[model samples]
Target: MASNTSLSSLSILIALLFLTNCQAARHLLEETPEVESPPHPTIPTLPKPELPPVPEEPTIPKVELPPLPVEPTVPKVELPPLPEIPKVELPPKPSIPSIPKVELPPVPSIPKVELPPKP
Candidate 1:
């Protein structure tokens, strides 16, 4: 894709041209010795040519534009009042049945057995 190079180069060229002109003007000013305008015999002044008077700035009197007609109040759109939210009656929780305790039978004691003496 071609890049927009004209603006970049133009700006750079403009800067260079500006610097060159400035340098040239500076050198001319610095090198030129100050000399007073040579005095000459007085000459009669020429009549200033009449320029048509700068046309009177047309007095565009601030036309009091009739106040912008008040925007007709848009009647507030009344949405049919949202149907009243229904109160939900939640069913009562069923009572949990009480668990019956079971009594465990007592464990029987085991008889001790004597073993024959090992050789």
Candidate 2:
């Protein structure tokens, strides 16, 4: 929010500067009618100077590179056979014991709460 305020203030300042510059320019122009009027100072004709031609780019000689050496063939290495892993047998899981059900007594009912009539 603070950034937005600063941005808006900056924009307003720029607009004010632009308006002030325009007003000053208009007043100056109005004050100098004679200078702005007839026979605008003729732009003095300047002689067109001849520019020297650009020099041609030098040609570079092509460099010949030596051929790359051939790679040597690698001999096939025989690896030793891996030993077989022995299988391990696990014991069977034991059965869970059954739990006995118990009978619960019934819950007593709550008595009604009575309120006296308001006067």
Could you estimate the TM-score for every candidate?
Answer: 0.29, 0.35
Error of 1 at 9 (Å): 99
Location of the lowest summed lDDT over 10 successive residues in candidate 2: 33-42
Which residue pairs of candidate 2 clash? none
lDDT comparing candidate 2 with the true structure: 0.92
Q: What would the per-residue lDDT of candidate 2 be over residues 1-119, giving only the tens digit for each residue?
A: 47988999999999999999999999999897574556767789999999999999999999999999999999999999999999988898898999998888999999999999999
RMSD of 1: 28.0
> What lDDT would each prediction earn against the true structure?
0.90, 0.92
Model 1 lDDT per residue over 1-119, tens place: 54579778878999999999999999999999999988898999999998887866777778676777777888888778778898999999999999999999999999999999999
Q: How many residue pairs clash in each candidate at the backbone level?
A: 0, 0
Over 4 Å off, model 2: 1-68, 98-104
